[model samples]
Target: MGAHNGVNNMHEVAPMEVSVEAGNFQDAERLDDDGRPRRTGTFWTASAHIITAVIGSGVLSLAWAIAQLGWVAGPAAMLLFAFVTYYTATLLAECYRTGDPETGKRNYTYMDAVRSNLGGAKVVFCGVIQYANLVGVAIGYTIASSISMRAIRRADCFHTNGHADPCKSSSTPYMILFGVVQILFSQIPDFDQIWWLSIVAAVMSFTYSSIGLSLGIAQTISNGGFKGSLTGISIGADVTSTQKIWHSLQAFGDIAFAYSFSNILIEIQDTIKAPPPSEAKVMQKATRLSVATTTIFYMLCGCMGYAAFGDEAPDNLLTGFGFYEPFWLLDIANVAIVVHLVGAYQVFCQPIFAFVERRAVAAWPDSAFISRELRVGPFALSVFRLTWRSAFVCVTTVVAMLLPFFGNVVGFLGAVSFWPLTVYFPVEMYIKQRRVPRGSTKWICLQTLSITCLLVSIAAAAGSIADVIDALKVYRPFSG
Candidate 1:
């Protein structure tokens, strides 16, 4: 396979040289092996991208998920999910190039990797799952950013009007504001162009996560010792047995969502520069570092939050009013969350934009609407791109306003996308690419792993649906 890919890449060499000759001296050096603008992405930039995508608003729900699953199961589920994600990410990274790690045709997206290794109807299936997941993430981030925005206002209200005050404010306007911000940021032309944004977002992720962890620890100390049981929230008058089962299952979805950047792993890999060291190896290292770093934060935040609030932990520890005093600090943390989501929203949505634009260009070929661009000072703006991306943000924002059940929505998305995008596809692609042989020990183990996750995803999705139904019984998201 590697030799075949090497031969194929050899064909591109002549065209690349011809194109360079047609252009300037600088163009040759600025081009990659594939004739695209040179990818300046390095280990640090790749790690930043992973960190920005991995540690998102989803982290805020870890404590709540932990609360449902209890001490033993909560931490265990997080670790298990992290390991599974990292393992599958490594597999997907190996699929980044069809033949040779360096010379093979690059798979620019998750769907491309699927088409290369497990071609057929599966490529279409992968596209549906991957893009749907990205859209859901865009919606989820919109909802999360609004939550933080309202938290800031609510915190100020409480501080000014006294704790007894209702301190209410609707999230609809905030969601709209966030949507507007995203519309502006969505115009960035390429993933590599946003490396600085990713770096800043990564820093903000750590900032808010550290703040949440710190607040949980302080609250735990004040309460004196840990407050949760080995079994987690107990079944009682407030919590029926049926609800307990649903919550526990939904916890699985939350944790799964927290570790899921696999859908974008290939897209991230595409930004990496040509390598003496393969892009797959660099991506593997980034995955390991990101998973380990996030896992530690998850443990501390989840455990401490459960300890602080016991059975009553808020769905979002920071925004759920778990810490009322030090209103200024809460304000800063919430601001950081808002800033982080601003970057995260783009991190998830860029692929969708690229996909649509690519398809339009291929289909239209020379149509002015698809091919023309207007100069805006320093940046060249595409008419179709600006309209399409803006409309996309608006649609997701409207949907987010209608269904802003942050925790449940994320759980549902995680459940729906986890097995297909994160596990099954990667596992299948790996088997086919490596020709692992049917019914062999290794192949059986991989299939078993995939099947187990599928069952888990089914249950988690069912649980999330139940939770959503229950939430709608009193759903008044636009109201404070």
Candidate 2:
């Protein structure tokens, strides 16, 4: 709805006017130069953004996760988490339309909802975790993209111990190159401006997932049975008790992380063009449709890839397969993943960019650099904007280079932020914003689920951190 500032009395503000208000010349002048559009996309485009945000490198690891949990538990966990996240998404959708179901205001961002319901220190806490998760995930995208590229280029030149041989490609240079390309793409001025990117990214996700599943089917047919059928699939069947416990927890974390999208839900909803009454409904539809589509892909990819490779599957599906002559299909799939992650990194980072820009403006009311745009190559660039964003991309790229274990970093990020961003914040904010009765069943069940997720996330986060630490002990820092 309206801003918390009370400058505007109406519930709905035009998308262009977001963060820009009457009497705020800085916000207004910045928009005038940027040509940012408002309320431009329909339901499908909004769903595309949701899909782009939801499906990332996580899908590639699902089969390995299924291997950890076995056939019966793996698909079960995916469906269960999908349903839970979809429900939480709907709750978050309701929070976006806060004041009136018909014409009252709505929250334009996830932080907006947090500020409205759980203000004070919670807002600051939310902002910290939110930006950390965004930046961390962007780093993860860098790591994954670079790894995928390196895998494609050097799959045949690796050592027996998994290190790249001398003369083989390293992830560092590829990461820097990817970051350079992403810095260019990240210059899009508005969230709505990148709808086309999201659409393309979504299509790429479908393409890669389909390819993975098809390759699995082909491999099974060629081999005439499952890859590890003799050894069994479940962790508990052959592994020690301690191994099973850790592996199962990691699997749970991976699946839960795969379903995470709450951090960007409100921002994606802000892209939808509709009347107040229809806005919430449209967002709900988009969320449901995106989740449903991703769920189907996850099932196909996870089950089929597991059937093909079983426990031998690498954390990254693409990396699991050894190099084949004329491996153009695998190369194409990796290219698609890299392209999709380029868009995804921007989608998550845009919020952090907006936050930093707004803070700079508010903290320094008289700074002239905020609105000054100069020509850089073909794009108009602001010194303040370019400086911070480039720094952001650089920070993530350096981190990716430092810790290039793509799956481990992703799990750590998900474990740390999934509870607050995906589960807890939405449920708590909904109950508080809507004033759901303390004793009501809806309140009780939602709160219970949120708490359970928090506890589980804590354990998962600890385990993931241990894995990262163990990885650090052996990994040569900055090694090429």
Candidate 3:
């Protein structure tokens, strides 16, 4: 449409700003400092973007993650992760501008930041990891949204047929349904939170998260008190010792995945308006706000969910029938989940869409198929965007079909990206940009943090991949 605040051209990354190089108006006034568009993002909007990014279906798995870690380590692990995420995120905020906190050249994307600072093969490495993780997240959202969609029907089935019916359902059809929805939303253009659908989705994020927490509390009270063990699921008849180790390691991945929003932190920061207080300071404030808020909710949901079901907590807090009796409530929660995930899928995938479209535009500047926009009602759509975005959705959907287990996929994605995106890149970029003296105390501390997270990421990845392999032994993707 006419610059839907949701799909405003401000998000176009200023690539073609040369045409408007005369200056001014990303729908902005005076062109601000960069001669592109006057930036308008504020601390609050940045906070919303971070919240929407961080708190999604990931929270749904924390109960299971805690079950693996247990009472003693579950909450402790979460707190540790909260600290790491915030610390690294602040370090990253500092790198938004290359040389100075306030005056350095702005790196519009995460790729741009790495390219400007790290250069060399590392830029390629960053791109591969960043985009690959984006693809993995797209697949994870497919699996997750489908699970929520299928849960809706199963919840009804259990209520109508009684819990004894088992009410089994396959996620295949639901995943396809989710893919179809994404294709339509994908065509809407831009993943900025200003979009109407995005705002609704953000509300749904809070809605379901609160619902999960409430359900956990209700279940805990219904059990007369709490229900788990200090050590979590015990290794005896039901679980082998080897299984215990793998599950615990996988739990770290799941938690890491929950906090995996650092990859797009710079993209989110790019939206902030030119400021006297500086984007870094505002972003730091927003990072603290978003992380603190999500962490509190994570703790409430994870600990209470573990307390309610103990070692036997469901892998998905909402869909796993952890609160089976309240059928309507379960439906509501799952619906909220699907809605949130629908938006989350688009939000996360927007970067991939932009990168490809930009490349195509660069390579074939005159091809109508590459450069033309087809009008639909009030809005203008690109033929290329339509084709590629739909194809991407389909690819993700099929991949999700092959590997539908949410926990393992989420963990593996997190493990693969956590060390690189969240910890290492940020730490290295900060060290280089700030030029902490070689082998200095600050340098040593940052290196230690990076190394520790690398180990964690490695263990988590191994555990997730093992579980995936084991799952493949008996599970067939499209079997009825």
Q: Per-residue lDDT for 275-326 in model 1, tens only? A: 7588999989988888898888788888888899988888888899978978
Model 3 Cα shift for residue 95 (angstroms): 0.7
Candidate 3 least-lDDT 10 residues: 1-10
TM-score of 2: 0.86
Please write out the lDDT profile of model 3 over residues 1-480, one tens digit for every residue. 011132233453343334453443333433556755556777888898898889888898899999998898999999999999999999999889998777789998898989888999999999999999999999999999888888899889989988889777889999889999888878765654325666778899899999999989988998999988888899999899988999999999999999989998998898787656899999999999999999999999999999999998988999888788688888898899988888777777878887888898889988998777887753457888888999999999999998999999999998999999999989989989988998999999999999999999999999999898988999976752
By descending lDDT, how would the candidates be arranged?
A: 3, 1, 2
Clashing pairs in 1: none
Clashes per candidate (backbone, < 3 Å): 0, 3, 1
Task: Give the total clashing residue pairs for model 1.
Answer: 0
Using Cα atoms with residue i matched to residue i, what is each candidate's TM-score against the true structure? 0.92, 0.86, 0.93
Q: How close to the true structure is residue 458 of candidate 2, measured as C-alpha lDDT?
A: 84
In the range 56-122, model 2's lDDT, one tens digit per residue, is 7899888888887777778888998898889888888877766775555657788888887789998
lDDT of each: 0.85, 0.75, 0.86
